[model samples]
Each structure stands twice: as C-alpha cells, then as structure tokens.
Target: MSDHERKQLEDFLAAIEPNIAGYNYSTFSYLAQKKGNVFELAQGRLVLQGVPATSESKHFESPNLKVGFLHLHELKTSVKQFIESLLTGKLLTPHGELRFAPEKDRSHSIYFNPFHAEGVPFQNRQAFQYRQMQLHIRGDRRERLDSLSLDWELKAGPIPFEGVQELCAEFGVGQIDGDSSTVEIVAFSVAAIGGESSVTGTKAKLVINLVDGLEREKASIGYRLIERNAVVKRGILSGDALTWENATNFQRGVAELEVTGGAVLHCVASHGGRAQHHYWVADPATAQNPFRAIHQAFDKNLDVLQELVTKAQTKGANARDLEIAVAWLLWMLGFSTTHIGGTPKTSDAPDLIAATPFGHLVVVECTTGILKEDSKLSHLFQRAEKIRQTLISCGNQHLRVLPVIVTTKTRDEVKSELDQAHKNGALVATIEDFPQLINRTLLVPNAERLYTEAEENLKRLQNPSPFDVSGTKTNLLQ
Candidate 1:
C-alpha cells in the first residue's frame, strides 16, 4: 500500500480501537508466501493439533487469540466487516453485555437480548424466535454528554430454498441445496453521537444469513439507513398543512443522512457483496446540480483534463492545442464530429461548428485571451456578428450561434464588455464552468429540450425590459 493508504488504514484502526479493546483483541503480523503483511487478530495463544504422527504440532506463543484475518488490499472492507462481526459476537456472548469503560471516565454499554425465547408476532412459532437488544454509546467532548443509545430486534429462522437460487445472481459463490437454519431479520438504529451538532434518530435494517456456514458464499446482507426528517413538502393542502418553498433544511438533513448511510453501506458491502454494493443518495436538490454528477461520472478522467488545462495555462497556450482540447470537450459532452474552424490569424471563420442530435446547428467562436480593451471587445463582436451572418445565410434557420471566449482570468472591464455582448446575443462562459455546462447539457437527454432551453435563456438575456409596467396607473390599481 502507498503511504496515504497506510495512513487511512491507521486512522480507521484507531477510530475502532475502543471497540477492539472492549473485546481484548491483539494483532498477529507476519509475512506470508502468497500474501504480504498478513495481519490477524486473536485473544490468546493459538495452537494447531491433529497432524500426522511424524509431524509435530505447531503452536503460536502470542497470547492474542485469532478471531479474524485481513488482507492488505481489502483493508478497509475487511476491517469494517471485522468490526461488525465483533459487535455481533459481543452481543451474543454468554454475559449478554459488553462495556467500554475507562478509569475516571464515563462508560458505554451494549445490552444484548437477555430474553431470546420470546417469539415474533405472526411468525411461525416453531420456525423462528425474536430477540430485542439495545446499545449505549458514550463519548467525551468539551463536557460530559448523555449517552447515545439504539434499540433493535432480530428474528432468526431457517433459510429458504429460494434464497439459494437468488444467491447465484452475484458473481462467485458456489451452489447449495437444502434449507440452512441461518436466516435473520435485523432491525436497528445507527445512533449519531458526538456533540450537540450530531444528527440522531436514524434507523436501518438488514436481512441475511447469520451463520458462518456458507462454504464459499459470504452472507447475503442488505441494509438501508432511514431518515424520517429528510422530506420536502410537495404542496400545501387547502387546510392547515405544510408546504415546501425551500429545500435548505431538507438538504442539510440529507447531508447528515449521507454520513450515517455511507457507514451502513460500507459495512454491508464489507460483509455481503463488495463488488455489487450500490448506495443511492436520493436528494433531488443535490441531484439537480448536474456538475456534481458529471464530476462523479468522469472522476477517473478529471485529473487528466485538469492537467491539460493547467499545462495550457502554464506554457503559453498553442492555438491548435486549445482548439483540439475544446473539440475533445465538445465530443465528451455528446457532440459528434466537431469541426474546428479558421487557422489562427488566417481565416475569419468561426472556431467550432457542431450540431445537436435534433439538428440544431451550433456555431462557436473560441478565444483564450482576455477581452479587457475596447479594441479587443470590438474585434470579438465583429467576428461573432460575422459568424452569425454566415450561419444565417446557410439557410438552416434552426442554427444557434454561440461565441465563446476562453480566458484564465476575468477583469471588471472584460466582464462588463462580455455582459453587454451576452445581452445582445453571445454567451460569456469561463473555462472553469465548461465542465458544468457540458454535464448540464448531457443531463438533458432530449436534444430538442436542450436546444429550446438554451435559446430561451439567450432570448431572456437579450431582452432586458420587464414584461409588466410597474409604474403605470393600471399596475397601481391592481
């Protein structure tokens, strides 16, 4: 692992150290033939027997007993799973309780189901049993705080035959037959504890195989974190009802939910199916930001694009390189066969010509220099107008002309000129906003809607006058 990855692992280990200490665990580290840096956890000396008479029994002098083994490559996922198993094992211990209490400090406790014989309501009496449990978590900030607690219940029963069939859908995992008495229904709350700012009252559920008897198939665990307050008012009723005019509170609540939800998903992925794990953040307000989604979609390629943009700025940008990069960006935004126009200082043609899928032609004039001076502004306007005329004369009335000036910085003078140009007909967009625009365009699956939206925005910019006469006598009477 790299230094950064090792640090991440160390931090994670430290975060869960209290829980590990509660279980009296220690690590056994050694080198393996196939795996590097083999780390295993245990509580006491581990010994292996039952070998052939000719071979002597092997014994480990380490007092720590082995409870889990982890591979470095799967460090995060494995650690998460190990922690879950530790929590579950502690709850199922004979004492039915686990406490994390230090000298001269507040104590936290987890209480398991002291009464496991109780049957679930409407369950097959002979087939299943229910057990209620609770967990109390304590922490110290600036002052002593109330213990954060979570209550939960579980139902254990025999695994069904269809469960085996469904397990085949995921890659890996051997086939199995016959019912395994290992299914469980887990309902618990993931308490958000720390300071007053911490979000509380989040519930989650998991239904899966509980027994570690699956030969090659890990447990099929599924989980979801539920936040009751994460809701927006659709509309108000005629009577006294709630209405959602803004999403500020909802957004804030969802952000908290993401933290708790991400943890639960991480644990599930660790124990269930790491490759198939998928978590959906269902915040419509955040989803509307196409730029964020686009960044996520191109996360792997963003560094390369950023590097190119930086290189262009650091080394005086070559016109050809900038044009080619812009062309590539257009293509990434779903444009097909982008054509770069006019050699630098040679032709008066537009810099780019492309068409939307719906036949809406786009003519673009690209530049990399700041338009701070009147001469530069005038030259840009003339070029854009010329391009607009050329496009109109082509007889394709569906064409849309966009003059784009790319620059590293925007001064007040340049911005003033660009704003005026935009009001007239052109668009002034920074190089940084290009990714956002591209993502927004791609988000609109319908070509006609995209074209219409762009045209409407431009028209709105061009017309600065208000629709209503605010100072008129008619307006005053109304």
Candidate 2:
C-alpha cells in the first residue's frame, strides 16, 4: 500500500478503538498465562463422582468415585464445536447469519456475520441497552480485505443506567458499568472476506422505541422492515404498510422511508457517505417554490400609480406627483434623474433632468394649470433656458427639452395658447398626450431620432401665418 493508503488505514483503526477495547482486554486477561507459547479457550462436559465416607473422617465421602478433565486437544475441539452450534443456532435474528472460512491467503481463520444480501449491516447486538450501531466501509481498496467495522455505543439515549443494564440482560449481551447511566459496548471488526468489498442488499430492518409521554411513563417497541432505497410517495405510512415487501425505488441512488409520520431519506452509491449508507430525516417545508411568491408581490405593486392619482388633494400637487412618478418611471427605464422643482434657489430650473440609457440628456418643466397667452409661457422658456445652460456647462452635446402641462382642461381648450408657445421654440405636451410622448421617445430605436422627432413636432404646432423669425427660434437656436 502507498503511504497515504497506510495513513487512512491507521486512522480507520484508531477511530474504532473504543468499540473493541473491552472485548480485547477481557480476552487478554482470561488467556494471559500460557502453558507453552500459546493459550487457547477450552470447554467440556462436566460430571460428578461420589466417594464413600470413612468412620474417622469428619468430612463424608463416597467410595469408588472418579473425576477426570478432558485433554487439551479434546478441549479445543469441543470449544470449536460449541461455537459452531451457537453461530448456526436460533440465538440471532432470522435475518442474521454467520460464516466461518479460511482467508484467501490461508494465513488465518475467518469468522463473521456474512449477511451481504442485507442492505447496510446495522446490527443491535445488545437489544435492551440504549445504543447506536454503525457500519463503516472503505471503498478505495480493490484487492485484499478493505476494512470492515461494526461499532456499538451504549447508554446513548434517554434511558437510565439501570434500565440499560436490564435491557442488556434481556438481550443476552455482556454489560459493563452496570450502575452507571452511560457505557460503551464492545465493537466487532473483521478483515475483508474474499470477493466481498461493497455492501449489497435491498432491504433494511429498523427497530424503534416509542415513549408515551415526556415523563416516559409508558413505552412500546415498534419495528419496520423497509426497502433499502425506496422513494416514499407519501411521507406517512400505516403500520402494516411499513415494510420492504411493497416498496419501490423513486429514483436511482435516492430512497425514502416513512418513520413516525415523517420520512427518513437515504442516498446510496459506491463511494462517500452514500457507500457507507447515510440517512437523514426529510423536511417537508423545503419543497415550496420561491419564485411564485416573488411574482405575487410584483403583481400587487403594478397598480400603485393609479391608487396615488385617486387620493391626491390639489391639482398642482397632483401634477407634481405625476412629474415625480414619471421621473421614477424613466429611472426604471434605465435613466438617472434629478428632481429640481421644489428647490427654492433653483426655481428657474426645470422640474426634472434625466440622463437616458442611450447617453442623451432630457429636461422637463411641469405645470398643473392651463398654459394660456400669459407669463406661464415665459416661465417655461426661462426653466428650459436654465436646463440648457446647465447641460452646456457640463459639456453635454445632445439634449431634449419638453414642457409638460397637466391640467383638467382638454387639448382643444388650450390649442391656441399651446400653438403660440410652440412658435417661440418650446416643445409642449398636455396631460392627455404626455404618456404617449414618453412612450414614443423610449420605444424609438435611435436617441438622435427621438430628439429630432420632438423638435419637428414642436415646429408643426407653430402658427402657419408669417411671424417674426427671431422670436420663433429664440430657444431653438440656442
């Protein structure tokens, strides 16, 4: 073996030390004294003989009696025979069986529980004690016996020390620390058997203890023979249906088995935890779809703008709200916006200035009342001029400016005044047309074309009759 493989083997041996310590110590103490260079366990049948009592003797004895001990060879043979009887006997469960054979190299005798047809071997040696049993298998080694170990822990549950002792006796397994609440059991190990390295089986037998209440006043035993890797369609199972007899695999490598109204999920493979047969309880809550919840929340927020429009008090405030809403809409459409309408020192500034995703700037001026033949038009021009100067100072070469008037009045009602303002080089739109204008600008394929269309639309709104060229092109020329 390579150095790394040797280290892994050493680690595996170190981890299972506690499991076999008790058995090794007891066996060593029993056979410590040697007649020659070796010592062995012996057994034989016992017989009693009688000796006759003498008149002068205080102790009575029967005459013509004899006692004899078996020879070492006979003793060894008898012991082996007894052990073979025990292994093939009904002492172990029907699902358990023993095997004794010679190692492949014929260097040592091999005796072990060879139940490879059973899933992973989870044997509870001492049925009465609160203990845990585990089987660890190493899969990397192909030749020779990969390490096989059966580990046992005692008093590993809520049961008291005396309770475990009684259980150990009931189960017919030796117990240590009879008075202590917790103890460790002897572990069993075997070198690999010939042609056997991986676990192969299709069924598992599970035994569980049920307590009636928290105080543990009453208890009962329950067992289920389940398929090794079955997928449970329903996590719950009735008492009679909990068995490997009717189970089927849900998917390759994964299996589920019901336990106490829940489930025990298992993953089996040829390597890693799966190779060693690891299992855990499946949680039901993790099966929910997360995106469904997100979509529900998204649909709920889609009508928020209409709700805000219905609840506002004044037309001016309503118009301002719409402007801010539109600015946010532009931001969501991949633009950066600044709301300057409410800043006292920047009153001449446009209500909003935004940088579009296509690398152009847009300035907007908003009004809640009708734009008539009055100072409102001059104020719009001043705001537009301020925005133009700001963009020029920042070295912005391409920009679009729009004057938006959101009023209760219809488009026809302010057509004359809107026409006059447009002649003075102001791009204007009423409340009813604002949304359409924004949509058109956003949907256009080219940013330059969007600005060009806005300018042409403004020119189309000018008076057809001859007018002063200087006044009409005032802001447009700049």
TM-scores for the candidates: 0.34, 0.30
lDDT score of residue 460 within candidate 2: 51
lDDT of 1: 0.32
lDDT of each: 0.32, 0.32
- Per-residue C-alpha lDDT of model 2 across residues 208-254, encoded as one tens digit per residue: 21111111111111222222223433332222332212112111111
- In candidate 1, position 390 carries an lDDT of 70
Q: 274 in model 2: Cα distance from truth in Å?
A: 72
Q: Candidate 2, residue 244: CA error in Å?
A: 58
Q: Pick by TM-score: which candidate is best? A: 1
TM-score of 1: 0.34
